[model samples]
Target: MSIENDLTEFISRDVVPEGGVTETELLISSGKVDSLGLLQILGFIEQQYGVTLLTSGSPKDFESVQTLASAIRKARGESA
Candidate 1:
């Protein structure tokens, strides 16, 4: 699957709680994810894509699908 799809599925299945909604929406702005969820998502990305995610500044930097995908591509040494 594409990286976006993988990210969407991960957010839908793992991050969103019951009766919650997940999309390419502003996850941080919407408060859909907390600090713990951010960490979990980072770990999930690392485990799934076989890449390490290093945090710089705030964890919110990795909050959105686009940001996470870019990070993954960077970790894989692929063009983003």
Candidate 2:
């Protein structure tokens, strides 16, 4: 599956807890993800892509599925 699709599924299955809507463009910082939730996402990324993703600047930097997919692509050395 594409990174975007994989991330969307991960968010739907994991980040949002038992059952919640997961919109790809939804802002993660808008209470959809808390601190613990961010850790879950990072952990998922690490396991799925076998790469560490550093959230260097801001939480907003990783606020959407599209952004997460971009990070995955960059880690895999694919053009972002």
Candidate 3:
């Protein structure tokens, strides 16, 4: 599975178990994801991608599956 797919599945099971996330869905702003959930996501990105992402603590970084994937790619020195 791709980064977006992985995040979507993980968020669905662990974060927002009630309503699954879409690639373009609002996560943090929508209140579907909280601080703890954000930490879980960051940890997942670090462990799964082998990249300890240094972020600006921007909600945009954790906005959606698409944005998160882009952030992860950027952290890995890949084009976002």
User: Using lDDT as the measure, which candidate wins?
Assistant: 3
Rate residue 27 of model 1 by lDDT.
73
Best by TM-score: 3
**lDDT of predicted model 3:** 0.84
Candidates in order, TM-scores: namely: 0.77, 0.78, 0.87
Number of the candidate with higher lDDT, 1 or 3: 3
lDDT of 1 by residue, 1-80 (tens): 88878887888788886544444577777788887887788788778888767543245546678777776786678987
Error of 3 at 9 (Å): 0.6
- On the 0 to 100 scale, the lDDT of residue 1 in model 1 is 87
Q: Flag regions of model 1 displaced more than 4 Å.
A: 18-23, 55-61
**Clashing residue pairs, candidate 2?**
none
Worst 10 residues of 3 by lDDT: 51-60
lDDT of 2 by residue, 1-80 (tens): 88777877887787775565354556455677777877887888888888677644245448788877776777678998
Off by over 4 Å in 2: 18-23, 55-60
Query: What clash pairs does model 1 have?
Result: none
What are the clash counts of all predictions, listed in order? 0, 0, 0
